[model samples]
Target: MNTTPPRVLTIAGSDSGGGAGLQADLRTLFACGVHGMTAVTAVTVQNSLGVTGFVEMAPEVVAAQILAVATDIGVGAAKTGMLASAGIIEAVADACDQVGIGRTGTTPFVVDPVAASMHGDQLLTDLALEAVRGLLFPRATLVTPNLDEVRLLTGIDVVDRAGQREAARALHDLGPEWVLVKGGHMWADPECLDLLFDGSEFVELPGPRYDTKHTHGSGDTLASAICSRLARGEGVVEAVRFGKEFVVRSVRASYALGAGVGPVSPLWRLEG
Candidate 1:
C-alpha cells in the first residue's frame, strides 16, 4: 500500500482569520486528500470583515521557501495567491522555473489571481498586478480569476456568458494554457457558471447559486481543489469539474464565523 499522498504547494499569504489565503488552501488540499506545502508570501491582519494590514516576505525569502520544499519533498502541483508586490511576483516566477512547476515544467501551476479580499480590500499593488500578467501568466498552467480580477487584469467587465468568453480569450492571450473565468461575482446570474477555455475549446461548469454571504475563501477553495485533483493525476478539464463540484458542496455546507462573512467549508468532505 502506498502511504504517500500527492503533494501540492501553495505560494500564498496567511489569513490570520484562517478563512482564506494558504489556510484555506491547506484545508481544501487536505480535504481533497493531498499533502499541502507552503511558501508564505505575505502575512495579513484580517478577519471575516476585511484585511486591515499586511507584511510581505522578502523576495529572496519567498524564493528560498519554494526551493526548499520543492527540491527535497517534491511537488505534484502548486498554486499562488495574494503575492503583494512586483518583486515577490518576479521571485515567484523565477523560483517556479527553477523548480519545474509551471507551464513548461513538470508540475502544474494554478494562478488564483487574488487581487482583493471579498470585502473589497486591495491585497496586491498595480505593479504586482502587471508582474502577474507579464511574468506569472505565461508560466501558469491554469489562471483562475474571478470577475473583478478579470476586470483588473484584462479590462473586461464580464457581466454575462458572452463577456466571459471575451475575458477568457483576453486572458488566454496573456499566455496561460488554460483560463478559468469564475462567475461567482456575477450576482444577477441565476446559476453560477464558471467558464474554462484552453485556447481552442471551452467548457462551462454550472452550479447552483447558493444564497449565502459566507463565501470568503470560495476562490481559494476552488483553485486549491483543482490543484489537488491535478496532483492526483487528473487532466485539466476533469480536475476543474471536480473542483467545481467540491466548491459547490462546500458553499452549501458553509456556516457563519466572525462578525461579517464566513468561509466556505471543506468540512463537507468529512461528512458521512
Candidate 2:
C-alpha cells in the first residue's frame, strides 16, 4: 500500500447540486491529489442554478463532526465555508483548538467568509459575522473574501487593485494571519486581480478574466483548492496561483444545469 502525501479537511456546508460547498471542496481536493474529509455544517436544497434553502446543523453537531474528523484520520489543512451562525463558528473554532493542527503545531485554516452563496442568497446573519470576526479569523491561516464579502466584512470598497490591498490589510487586522481580497467584481478590469496581504507585504495575483456567467461557487472552490494545495506543502502564493488556474478552467468549462446562473465545475480539469 502507498501512503497519500497529505490530508485535508473541509468544515463546510453541503451543496446538493454538487457544484460548491463541501462537495466542491472534496472534488477539488481529490483532483489536487490530496485526501479529502468533510464535516458538514449545513445542508442546502440547491442545484447548479442556485440555493433554494439551507438548514444549518446544530452547533453541537457541527462541533462533533469537527472532532470526529480531527481525532482520527487527520488533516494538514482545513477550510471553512458557510458557517450559518455565530454559535456554529464558535464551536468550530473551539474544536480546532482541541485537535491541535498537527506536527507543525498549527493547522492551516482557510476561511472563505461565506456570508452569502454565489447566487446572492443570504447565508450568514449579522450576528454570525460578529462571531466570525472575533472567534474564527484570529485562527485562520488565510481568509479569502470576494469584493462584496470584503466590503461586508471590512466595510471597505475595493473598487481597484490598490483598494483591494487596503481592504486586505484591514481584514488582516481583524485577525486572519493572511487575507486574499478577490477583484472579480471589477468588471471593467482586463483581468482577475487578487490581492493577498500577509501582515507585511501585499502580493497581487493577476489572471486573464474569462467572460462568462457560469461563475457560481468560484470563491469557495478557490479557497478550498488553495487549502488542498497548501496541505501538500505549497506556499501561500503558489497555492493561490494554482487555485486561480483551477477556478478559471472550471469557469471556462462551466455547464448549464438549471434556469439560472450555472456553477463552475471544480472538477473541470479532471472531467475534461
Candidate 3:
C-alpha cells in the first residue's frame, strides 16, 4: 500500500466552538491520514450546543481561495458543507466544476447539505437550499442529508427503511450522482442505518446506534471521512462503510464540553 498522504479540501463554515463545520472536517481528514485544506464560507458564533449567529464571507473571496488552492497545492478530493448563502454556494459550485473537470475520477467530492443545527438553529436559508439543489448537487459525487434535510431537498418524509429507499431514490433524481439518506433521525431501534443510492444500486449501511446528544458534527465528520478515503482511492461503497464506523466511534467517545450538547471527537483514536 502506498503511504503517501492524500490531500482533501473542505468548503464549509467556521465554528468558534471547534466542533462542527470546517473544524470537524479537518479533524476527520487528519484522523483518516489525509492532508486537509479548507475554504471557509461562513463563520458561526456557536457553542457546544448550537449556532447563535453566522457571518458569510464575500463570494469573491471564496472563489479566489478555491482558485488559489486549485492552482497551487491541488486537491485529491473535496467536500462541501454549510454554504450559508446563495452567492457563496454558486461560487463553490463553479469552482468545484473546475475541480471536477481537472480531478475527475481521482478526486471525488462528498457534499453535506447542512441545513440546520441539531438544536434547531437555521444554518441554511431557502435561497441557499435552492443554490445547493441547482448549483451544487449536480456536481457532487455523493450528497449526504439527514431526514429533515431529505424532506427539505425532496419533500420526502423518510420515516422507516422503506421511506429511506424512497427518499434516496427521490434525492438521486435531483442530480447528485449518489444520495445518502441518513437514518440517524429515523424513529427506529437497534441500529443506525444510512441508505446510499448510486443511481444504479442501493447500499444500506447499518451499525450499532450510540445514543448520545453529543453529536454536533456527525454529518460533517462522516462526509469528511468519505472525502478522505476517496482521496486515497477507496470506492464509494467502501468509503461509506468506513465513514459510518468512524462516526460511530467518534460518537461513542463524545465528550460533553459545554452547557449544551457537545460534539463527537472525530480524532478520538489519536487522543493520548
The digit string of per-residue lDDT tens for model 2 on 1-272 reads 89866888888899898777888888878778888888888999987667678888999999898788778777789988888888889888888888875222477888888885564445678888888888888888888888778767887877777787788888989887788888888777888888888999888788878877877778877987898788888788888888888887787877776877677886666764
**CA displacement after TM-score superposition, residue 36 of candidate 2 (Å):** 1.0
Q: What are the RMSD figures for all models against the true structure?
A: 1.0, 2.0, 2.2
- Give me the candidate number with maximum TM-score: 1
How many collisions per candidate?
A: 0, 0, 0
Give the range of the ten consecutive residues with the poorest summed lDDT in model 1. Answer: 116-125
Question: Which residues of candidate 2, in runs, are more than 4 Å off?
Answer: 102-104, 119-122
Tens digits of per-residue lDDT for model 3 on 135-165?
7787778899988888787777777898889
Ten-residue stretch with the least lDDT total in model 2:
100-109
Spell out the clash pairs found in candidate 2. none
Residue 119 in model 1: lDDT = 49
Predicted candidate 1 versus true structure: per-residue lDDT over 98-171, tens digit per residue: 98999879899999988865745555778888999999999999999998899889888888999999999999
Q: What are the lDDT scores of the predictions, listed in order?
A: 0.93, 0.81, 0.83
* Native-structure RMSD, model 2: 2.0
User: For candidate 3, which ten residues in a row score worst on lDDT?
Assistant: 98-107
